[model samples]
Target: MPTLVLLRHGRSTANTSGVLAGWSPGVDLDDHGRKQASAVAERLRPVPLAAIVTSPLDRCQQTLAPVWADRDLPPVVDERFGECRYGDWTGRKINDLVKEPLWKVVQQHPSAAVFPGPEGEGLAATQARAVAAVREWDARVLESHGKDAVWLACSHGDVIKAILADAYGMHLDLFQRIVVDPCSVSIVRYSETRPFVVRVNDIGGDLTGLLPPPKSAGNKDEVDASDAVVGGGAGTV
Candidate 1:
């Protein structure tokens, strides 16, 4: 078995501005996002991580910076974990997108939703690639680090939601029910029989329990989610 921790990149400029960043470049984290990144890094410091995998987007890289600084572990850039390609809708305002007929399809039946344009990618296709990536990574980690290995995957909201949907054995159309906020953490442990979801959208928690007792011992930084007070933020594809 191996533990996979999915962390959504902190709030980005596009998020604050109410735009869908999609695969657009030059979108970095805001000040509040920087704080959220730092806080998440501190929260996970007590847990032993085998590797850190991140999307190639700037926002994801920026979010991983603080964790790299704290743990000195370089992140492996994986494009499979990148944000959904919104095609012609890239960089468009959410309010405007909501007015489109396809927006309702995206919300109600994501499996049938497809972005417009030559490079448009379907929502089901996105989920397929993302789930494949995570499963492949999970197998690799188990082989290299053995069971109990824990790793972090930094990606966008929709991307993480798709992965969670697969982990829960839910269809792509039901994925919209899952909410992956900026800087939020969700954990999944994959075993031979099934996958166990330990936590979802956990802003803060005593993850020390998830860590091996030997590694977590003597770590006074361990604090329960209720004891940790952290602010919330938002995100988009």
Candidate 2:
């Protein structure tokens, strides 16, 4: 088993402008986003990450840039971690999209929601693929590394929310109720039986405890209670 850290990319121009930058190219982290990325990097600096997986998007890659800049490990780009394909709504503003008839379904019943375009992707399908990708990565990391291995996945808000929903065993319709903010960190430790959700939507806090103590040192069996800190937040899509 391994600890998977889900990190959403920092605030982007689209987030500030209230636009839906779904799978849209050229979307990058804003100035404030750069600072947030730096903060997240520093927060996890002490943790020994086995690998870093990132969505194949500019914003995600840009957000991960600072973290990987000083490390020898490069990111593994996975398209499954990319943003929900909004189809015709790809570059549209969220304000205008809210007026659409399917907006209610998107917010209230995302499992039934479908992007209105020929190439659009369904919310359920998005959740399945994203969850599968995370599970695959988790298994691969554990097999290659060890039970206490730690890794990071940089993705979009919706994608991270979908993965969180799967980890919580929640139905897809209830996924919209999970809010993953910009540059937030959510931790999940997979075990032989089930996954333990250590933290969710953690923006800023003491993360030193998340680092695994030296294996070659004494008291390797001792568990840090602070590592299991739990908190909650209101949900938003």
Candidate 3:
């Protein structure tokens, strides 16, 4: 069995600002996010990693930068691991959108919701795409590197949870229960026999004998024009 780890990027500028950062363009990680990724890297330093995969977003790469720097590793950027596309809702303040009727419904019923904009991917589509991406990546790793290689992936919060749900046979409503904080870690075991969850939503440096064991982890949207074309991306380690 190969150990597959999915890590959410560390905190970003938009995360601290309380804004919705869908597929925007330039947002990057904050200081705390960097620290989180650094901590995760330290934790995995001893494990020989077969590959470190990430979303093609600055924040995601930035979060894992410290880890890669320390371990002398490089990550393979994959578009499939990107965050959910919120279309028109990208780059706007969360408070501003929360008041909109459609936004409220989407937040309350994300599984069935859709953003009002062009090029926006629905929750179903987002979930399906993320699941497919992970599966492909997992298959490739196992085939090329053998079954027991340690695989790591850094991705967005939504995509991480969606991937978990699909792999573990959980429902989308349970998505609200899983939280992958910036720089948090989630582990899954992939084998020719089956795929299993090892942990979910674990913050790096939190396992200092003070944190609880990994459990069924418990724990997003849209756009803007004049939006300054704010950028968005994914994170992982």
**Most accurate candidate by TM-score:** 2
> Of models 1 and 3, which has the larger lDDT?
1
Worst 10 residues of 2 by lDDT: 228-237
| Alpha-carbon RMSD, each predicted model | 8.1, 5.0, 13.0
TM-scores across all candidates?
0.89, 0.90, 0.81
For candidate 1, the C-alpha RMSD (Å) to the true structure equals 8.1
RMSD of 2: 5.0
lDDT score of residue 190 within candidate 1: 83
Q: Report lDDT (CA) for all predictions.
A: 0.88, 0.88, 0.75
| TM-score for candidate 3 | 0.81
Better of 2 and 3 by lDDT: 2
- List ranges where model 2 is wrong by over 4 Å: 213-237
lDDT tens digits, residue span 1-237, model 1: 789999999999999999999999899999999999999989888878988999999999999898888676899999999999999999999999999999999999999999999978898999999989999999999899977789999999999999999888899899999988999999988877667676888987667756743446677876432232255322111
**Model 1 steric clash total:** 0
**Residue pairs of candidate 2 with colliding backbone atoms:** none
Residue-level lDDT tens digits of model 3 in 128-219: 88878777887888788866667788889888988887767777756766777788888877655456676788764433221222334442
